[model samples]
Target: MDVTQSTAGDVIEVRPMTIHIGAELFGVDLAGSLTDEQVAAIRRALLRWKVVFFRDQALDHEAHVRLARHFGAPTPAHIVFGTNESHPEVYSIAKHRTAQNGRTSATRCWSGWHTDITAAINPPWASILRGVTVPPYGGDTQWTNLALAFARLSTPMQRFVEGLRAVHRFDAPAGDGDYARRVGARDLAAEHPLVTMHPETGEKVLYVSPGFVKEIVGLEPSESRALLENLWEHAVSTEFTVRFRWAPGSVAFWDNRATAHLAPVDIFATDFERQFYRVTLNGEVPVGVDGRPSTLLSGEPIEAQPA
Candidate 1:
């Protein structure tokens, strides 16, 4: 359904892309300061829709950080990927730059479905990704509502997952001995619930991230793999997902707590250039259905100062 709300005499258009997961929000400018009412409305839409897209936004590094501050504290760019030099909070997802630098290795961490930085004790609460340059075709990003995915599971399946936990790790790139050693020293691994409760909306989220999640805690490796495979297959079903074709000046803001997103694989097959900038918001430690919080297995949390 299309929702248009008039707040402070400004019409903010919220056009739902699907019954669940994604929406296109119009009428708000991210390059400038936002009013309290506008921020609140946007946050409400984010919680309800899981992810929101904005078209034709003009946001530089400073403006991107400033806009993200309205919702939550902006964390550093990434633990592994690092951030933009001048703007410490802005992480560039520059494909051309990485390709030029020969950083693309056998490890395909960023190419799979994941919630940002699950290896940390406190994963990001939300993420805002703005497209700087986009390809003409076949570089669409996709998101799935984990809450909805969990809701559709059988009652017995829900009960089993609620009591289970899994370890998430940032796999280091292959063939880089020194870099791999550094990553191994940091040991970016954390155990989080297979099912976690959303801190804001209080909805149950299927917290298995196929990219970072390694194995289920307290289970045999085979059993863990099998269970995780089933969960991953179910979580990414087409009905629970929404795909967004990106363009320059497009921005996607999503709640990291209740969603997992797939980065474009088709982009690598083409010679087209694609680049984007992302800023993540600080998130609390995930709490399971039994009211227990996730435990840090190795790495420190990616903490962010107050916005």
Candidate 2:
């Protein structure tokens, strides 16, 4: 649905995506920025559609950072794990020219499909990324519907997963590597429910990923890994995937709870660096779909089912 009413000089285009997941709000100069009403409408659209895209829209770093605040408070990234040093809110994700100690290349490879920091004591709710570098041919990012992932599971699968719990450790499965090489940041592994419900939408979403997931509760490591791997494979199935090619000034924002995204660093040691500024919305702890309270094996608080 295109909103047609506009001043002659202010006319802008809104291109909603053909699929159910994305939309490109074009023509409007975000410089004037969206009005409160327009911003609210954009938010409503984002909720209805999981992700929103804007093409040929440009905003400086300050402007970009400011725009994200419209959604929620911005979380300044912790430096050791953070990408950008200049702007705390912005992360420089390029791999080249980094000092050997920086491990920039290793950090840049996080392009795999994952929601941000589900392992954190309090994970982020959403993230907005501005596309500054567009790959000539192959680099593109794909996000899958985890909310839909949980919904699409067979009833038995859903029931089975619902009863299970997972531990998302800051542990990196860096096979045959030293512990420091595995996860350089402060160790941050914690147990979480397998099936998480979105706090805002109240809908269930699959919450496991390869990045930080450590183990499943109740099951032995072997059985847990097998079951989780099975579910992770299901989460990335073709039917739920949405791919996007980047253009300069293009932007994307998505609900971190219900989606898993993979950024293919398709460009080999080429000079291309997919630079962007990302701002995260702070989030609370998560709860599973089955309404069982989430509990920490240690001191962290899991949710308790309501009366």
Candidate 3:
């Protein structure tokens, strides 16, 4: 697709990647402090596009966290992973060198599409990820706009889901070794509406995804499984999705409340390495259309302090 750039009063140049869901912003240095107007412009683009990309940004761990604070408080790097001791809010997403050396043959283990930390009572409001060691080819991530996904469903289907709630839990892949063990220790879980009103934009989001949502509340096991399967399929349909190819120095900022993202499955097929660092903004409890908040099933809310 041809990227179309437009300037809005010298705030920033927005190069929309598609008719919906994704855009690339130009003329901002993520490494430096942002003026109030710059911050507001970035936030407005994020809410409208669901995800925005920046190319050739020179962002270190501290700069990454600093940029996040302009929009909201930064959450702990991750619930189960170790972060840099000095920069506790910067989470690394790199493959271990030891694991790389040991693997002569590879098996695909997809993380599946998910919003950031939905198992928490307050899932992250936004996430900023910067590419570090990008592969020469492949390892492209994709995101689906849940608000648009919900809007495209039949009227009756939308109404039926609006009243529903689902259970979300951080399910670590079994036999994944250390990472799995830590996630097992945490065992975070929550019950959230299948559809929630975006806290800032007031749009309804179809909140279920294969990564975290476990089952629909108050349904028979078989019935819940079948229903969830159907919803997951529709929520990630191509019409509501946008794919991004990553390069070193590229960064993506996304609204976690209104989107679910797929990690690069093709990376497993290549010997080339991929790595990234991310900081997530603390989120408010999601409210359903009926005006109810999500219920915590297990674990405490993620701890975060302003950056």
Candidate 4:
């Protein structure tokens, strides 16, 4: 299934998922990419695929930021203080991505399943990831379709979680007792609705961040614990997921509102330098299927509009 490019410049061959997913667009240039219509078409395919992989398109930092802006508002850098100072929108996810690592704050070892920023009142709308340094045969990133995940949930389970809320906290005290020591003590935590509709697309999506979700709303301690554990088990199931193998100059973009991702830890050896800049798209207030305002979550809530 070939997707036609917008203009007469170049005909991009979109190999539409004979293998897997919506489409892999070929012959599209990344440096000065496609026209607005072409970009919109790709965006439509991205929403359909849940994740889109662009193989071998090279992009510099400026170009990277430019591509990110095409989607919407630029997301503030992930709150890793030392690493992401140069670009207001781009952030460092690894230990060394920051300018200063001497006093590195502890981050959680994210081996489990999760979304990027569910703790925020309104998490990111989308994410475009570039693999700067990939390992020989591993270090792939897996994305789970939360929209589908929600749609496919057993009716009983869906009803059980329908009106429930969850506590999302970033300042969940990073230490020996916590899940991992790499993430530092979070200074902010907040509550958010469990099920929300994407503000733009209005699709129902599961809204939970694995690392930040502390408890479920209106449930007792034990019930909340059991519910969280159960929902997590449901969220990480393999049937609703896909893993993308990365290559140099390759990038993947997905709607964070409707997806959850897990990054492989294979590239961490003694001498490996794994660094990538991340910028989230500013998200609108999420609404539920019923069209009510969803609760604002996150200890460090960013302003609704761009700062």
How accurate locally, in lDDT, is each candidate?
A: 0.84, 0.65, 0.84, 0.65
lDDT by residue for model 4 (179-291), tens? 22324544445566688777656667777667667778788989987777767667767777787777778878778878788766556544555555566777765666566
Where does candidate 4 have its weakest 10-residue lDDT segment? 98-107
Could you give candidate 2's per-residue lDDT for residues 1-307 as a string of tens digits?
5454232343334555545466666555554566776676566656656777777867776776677777776666432254445556765545332211222222233326567766665667777887777766666778877888888899988888877788765544344344345354445656778888788788887887556566788788788767767788888887777777888888888878778787565565576666666667766778876666455443232221111
Off by over 4 Å in 1: 1-10, 96-111, 177-182, 305-307
Q: What TM-score number comes out for model 3?
A: 0.91
Residue by residue across 1-307, what tens digits does model 1's lDDT show? 3634444544577889998879999889989889987888889889989999999999998999999998889888776656556888888887754422322232233337888889898999999999998999988999999999999999999999999999888666556565564565567888999999998899999998777888899999889878888898899999999999999999999999999998887788889999888999988999999999999988788889544
* Counted clashes in each candidate structure: 0, 3, 0, 11
Regions of candidate 3 where Cα sits further than 4 Å from its true position: 1-10, 96-111, 172-176
Model 2 regions more than 4 Å off: 1-20, 78-80, 96-111, 172-182, 290-307
Point out the worst 10-residue segment of candidate 1 by lDDT.
99-108
Residue 55 in candidate 2, Cα distance off native in Å? 0.7
Return the TM-score for each candidate structure.
0.92, 0.81, 0.91, 0.82
User: Model 3, poorest ten-residue lDDT window?
Assistant: 98-107
